[model samples]
Target: AQTVTQSQPEMSVQEAETVTLSCTYDTSESDYYLFWYKQPPSRQMILVIRQEAYKQQNATENRFSVNFQKAAKSFSLKISDSQLGDAAMYFCACRSGSARQLTFGSGTQLTVLP
Candidate 1:
């Protein structure tokens, strides 16, 4: 069974500063995808960034980026110039090519301190 682990239960970042949320996973399959999903107070799950295992290049989207260490099976999210709007419960997820379901890690709550 594949599992995602988020060691941090909560994280805070000053407005305009940067923060990184750590995530590690255990998977037997080599072909898989990692994702960072943000669930704000509204409870809607939004895709922040995604990284494919085969790609050596880390995935980035605007203020969001991932540090993907494939060998260690670690994938972390880095938010640059953090904003209050970025406050949310972030979940790290993984999906193998053969599975339709995503295995999610315990969420890390990100608070943007003003």
Candidate 2:
């Protein structure tokens, strides 16, 4: 079974500071996709960024970027210029092309301090 792992239970960052959340996964298949999702108090899962296994380049979206290590099955998220609005629960998700179902990590709670 493929699974995502989030080592950090909680993380804090000052306003305008940058922070990176660690994540890892266990998968035997070579074809897969990694995703980072942000769940605010509303519980809406918003996609932060995503990386394709076949792609060597890491994915970046505005202030968010990912360090995707395919061999290690590690996909870490980096948030630059963090703001108070960035406070939320971040989750790591993976899906293989075969199953086409998402396997999500427990999650990492982020608190952006003022």
Candidate 3:
């Protein structure tokens, strides 16, 4: 069984700054995918970034990026030039290549301070 852990329960960032959210997982599978999903007040989970275990390059999308350390089983999300709209509950998730289900962390409440 695999599990995701998020040490920080909450995080805050001033507008236009950067914030990094940490995540680590325990898994025996060698092939899998890690993801960062953002759920705002609306409660819709949106995929922020994803990293494949076999890939060396970290995944990035616009202002969002991930620091994926496969060896250490660490996958963290970095939000740059943070906007107020970016405030949300972020969850770190993992899905094995053979499984369709996602095992998620408790979640980190990200507050963007003005």
Per-model root-mean-square deviation over C-alphas: 0.6, 0.8, 0.7
Model 1 Cα lDDT, one tens digit per residue, 32-78: 99999999997799999999999999999999999999989999999
Candidate 2 TM-score versus the reference: 0.97
Output the better candidate (2/3) by TM-score.
Answer: 3
Best by lDDT: 1
Point out where model 2 deviates above 4 Å.
none
- Model 1: lDDT to the true structure: 0.96
Q: What is the C-alpha lDDT of each candidate?
A: 0.96, 0.94, 0.95
What is the model-wide C-alpha lDDT for candidate 3? 0.95
Leading candidate by TM-score? 1
Ranked candidates (lDDT, high to low): 1, 3, 2
Taking all chains together, each candidate's TM-score versus the true structure is 0.98, 0.97, 0.98
- Candidate 2 overall lDDT versus native: 0.94
Those runs of model 3 whose alpha carbons end farther than 4 Å from true positions after fitting are: none
Give the alpha carbon lDDT tens digit for every residue of 1-114 in model 3: 899999999999999999999999988888899999999997788998989999999999999999999889999999999999999999999999888999999999999999
Clashing pairs in 1: none
Winner on TM-score between 1 and 2 is 1
